[model samples]
Target: MDELKGEWFETWFDTSYYHILYQNRDFTEAERFINNLLGYLDLPKNVNCLDLACGKGRHSVFINKKGFQVTGVDLSSNSIKEAKPFENETLSFDTHDMREVYKENTFDVVFNLFTSFGYFDDYDDNLKVLNSVNKMLVSEGLVVIDFMNADYTLDHLVEKEVKTLDGIDFNITKSYDGKHIFKNIDFTDQGKEFHFQEKVQAIKKEEFETLLEKTGFEIQNIYGDFSLAPFNKKESDRLIIIAKKK
Candidate 1:
């Protein structure tokens, strides 16, 4: 397949080193959240779902195991390639852009989890993703979005740190403008120096409310953390939204 055409996410997320850097991401916590969410959703046994920007399929694999037909798509071919080994009759992975619809009226649920959004510099592209997802869902289908609480994240931002993973010391610095968060990564590997950047919009809850409303979705529930508590803009670790297509 042709490589997914995009910007920084297209390049940075595809690198092997990216996986290495975040290798310790907590699958257990993710699974626990999934369990809580699925239990709350009580979706049918045979419902079809999509995992948008599903890098390497950790959550996709587990979601499929819970008896849903799951299709995982990511902008990175390398991530799709890594995720393909777990594919089966009911679970599949593909390389696709999130701003485009994969299939019209195809899925009963769509999951954009783990802060997999806010990559685009163009705000319209953000609308494109939600609009395409709106088109892709069946009537009243659910879309679950797990995103960072911009205020809380900024408040707790670590300005600088170095993490040594697999004998490579990754020097990292994080900064936030009034609009976006920037993480600068500098490191040396095999005597070659490298620098890569990650940028994400610090979209607030009110902005999301506007986005969902404009895109024909009804906000069903909003949670603060993985445990599914009520959202508090000041104290929450994550902004978990469950919206239903109108």
Candidate 2:
């Protein structure tokens, strides 16, 4: 239960406030993306799937509803506990680290969605995640990584904002230092002020391609957005990469 391990994500993501801050994420849009991906992949019914970094099993639930067996894994024990209610014969959730391979050559598809990456300070740590993904896949299995388009994000950076949600005033500031984007979030809850920092490495498309190549995956396709549009470096909101095991 040592949530504060020096990593910003290790502390921030375990709090209830994190969920409150992101509660407005578009579920319909995510569902559309998942459906589009499922159609595009045309994976076999019986093949197992892994929802890597699946927070609270939303995507896992959707995929399982599509009749695919899924195992959702996340680093947050609280997330796993909340997700366990959705488990059944074909759906399960476990607390796990993405840098370690949970089951070798077991899943037909692995999904790392919603910018649930780039948290590690060291680039090699990110590479370790890719290696783990590669090891967890069957031969020719597919992996989809959904990440923010760094180029576009840098171009459209919002420096500061103040918002009130549920009577809590959140003051947020953002900055990017070439290699990483940092967000400083300040808020007051129950008369006590609190501050949290979130840092994500600003990994680019070329860097990801290099990592995937090094990890023994063949690049299958790259989409620009949740709608499966072709990737345009400066225009896309998301960088969705689909790769197959070599």
Query: Which model scores highest in lDDT?
Result: 1
After superposing candidate 1 on the true structure, give the runs of residues whose Cα lies further than 4 Å from its correct spot. 1-6
lDDT of 1 at 84: 98
Taking all chains together, the TM-score of candidate 2 against the true structure is: 0.97
Error of 2 at 59 (Å): 0.7
**Local accuracy of candidate 2 as per-residue lDDT tens digits, 1-246:** 123465787688889888888888899999999999999998889989999999899999999999999999999888999999999999999999999999999999999999999999898999899999999999999999999999999999999998777778879999999899999889889877888889998899999999999999999999999989999999999999999999
TM-score of 1: 0.97
Give Cα distance to truth, residue 128, candidate 1, Å. 0.3
